[model samples]
Target: MIPLQRISVSTRTQTLLTRWTKHVQDTGATTKAARAQWKKAKAPKAKVRTALESMARGAVRCMYCDDNRATDIDHFEPLDEAPLRAFVWLNHLLACSYCNSNVKRSQYPVDADGACLLVDPTAEDPADHLELLLKSGRYTAVSGSAKGEETIRVFALNRPDLVKGRMDAFSRACSNMRDWHQLCQEADPEADRVAQALLDSPFIDVVHAMTRLKPSVAAVVVGPRTVPALDAWRSAHGF
Candidate 1:
């Protein structure tokens, strides 16, 4: 998961959410009340869903899984824990149905110090906590990052199909990089198109990991011959 920017919703929509929050609080701040109110907003109104999608990753991918299309507005902090923040924009995350309901559910882990152990993509960069293994399509928690471990566990980030997607994305990215580099060398008119295609590709984090590759990277998916293409691609994209 990458860090996301929360763009503002329409002023009228914001007012509606604010009013909903107050309405829920007035009803004793119960979980049932929060769910009922959110159901009304999410189903019929849909302003929150649209706003969250606008803040999502490429092609409106889930903020947690980053694979499937996001269709749910997840409460990063579970509704039971922070009932008052139910309609708060800051707590909302765009997520897929699987990640929002099946995977995460209501599992909210906190460290002994009472600090949240889940990575909030809008609040923190996932790179600081998690390291993606491009070749194997797995993630390792960075040293001293419990949040990364929990996030991986909660979202099932290393699931087989998803891992395959990342692995496949690596190969495609390498091919695209070679093509992009060739275009750059020739000053082809199609270079911009190729560049935009890369930006729109799935498993964008893999593309990101490729750009972050350095001499210290001992086990990358690509081999020695592709290093120059990778470097050239990085330069072409100003990475």
Candidate 2:
């Protein structure tokens, strides 16, 4: 998961959600009841989900996995803990069924300090807490951050299929970059097209891994590191 800029919902929708939340609160209903109400009243609305999918790169990928097609709206804060935010636009994220139903499924673990342990892609830059293992396409938590550990556990971010998917994407991206480099060596104008394709690839994290430049949030966690292969690749491209 990467950080995503959440889009604003229509004012009419926000007002309706506020009123609905207030009504649910007034009833003194159980979390389960509130969730049921949210599903009944809001889950079927396509416009809100369309907006979220728009945020997930025009519906091609899940906001969580960044690999699968987004098929559901995942509540960043599970309704069991923060039911009031159930219909709030910022709390919603596009997710795949595997990440949403099979893995996360209402599991919101918190640390002993009572702080949420899971990563909220909209609120946190995931790279700050998580690192990608390029060789295996698996994820590891930064030593001091429980957020990454918990998120990996809850989302099964290292599940074999997902790892394989990431590895495949990384391989494809590397191949394209190499081809682009070859084109440049031959003084071919097509090098630009190849470079553009790399930029446009859905597996953007691959490029991020190959470059030293990273989101500021990541710098705070990992500091600076020298990966010889990546550094060599970047230098060859004069990047």
Candidate with best lDDT:
1
lDDT, model 1, position 5: 77
Q: How large is the C-alpha RMSD of every model relative to the true structure?
A: 2.2, 5.6
lDDT of 2 at 194: 76
TM-score of each: 0.91, 0.77
lDDT of 2 at 161: 83
Tens digits of lDDT, candidate 1, 83-182: 8788988888888899999989988999999899998988888889999988898988999888899999999999888899999998998888888878
Worst 10 residues of 1 by lDDT: 213-222
Over the stretch 20-53, how does candidate 2's per-residue lDDT look in tens digits? 7776687675677677777677533565786786
lDDT of each: 0.82, 0.72
Which stretches of candidate 2 lie above 4 Å from their native place?
Answer: 42-44, 180-203, 212-239
Native-vs-model 1 lDDT?
Answer: 0.82
* Highest TM-score scorer: 1
TM-score of 2: 0.77
Q: lDDT score, residue 39, model 1?
A: 73
Looking at candidate 1, what is the lDDT of residue 33?
86
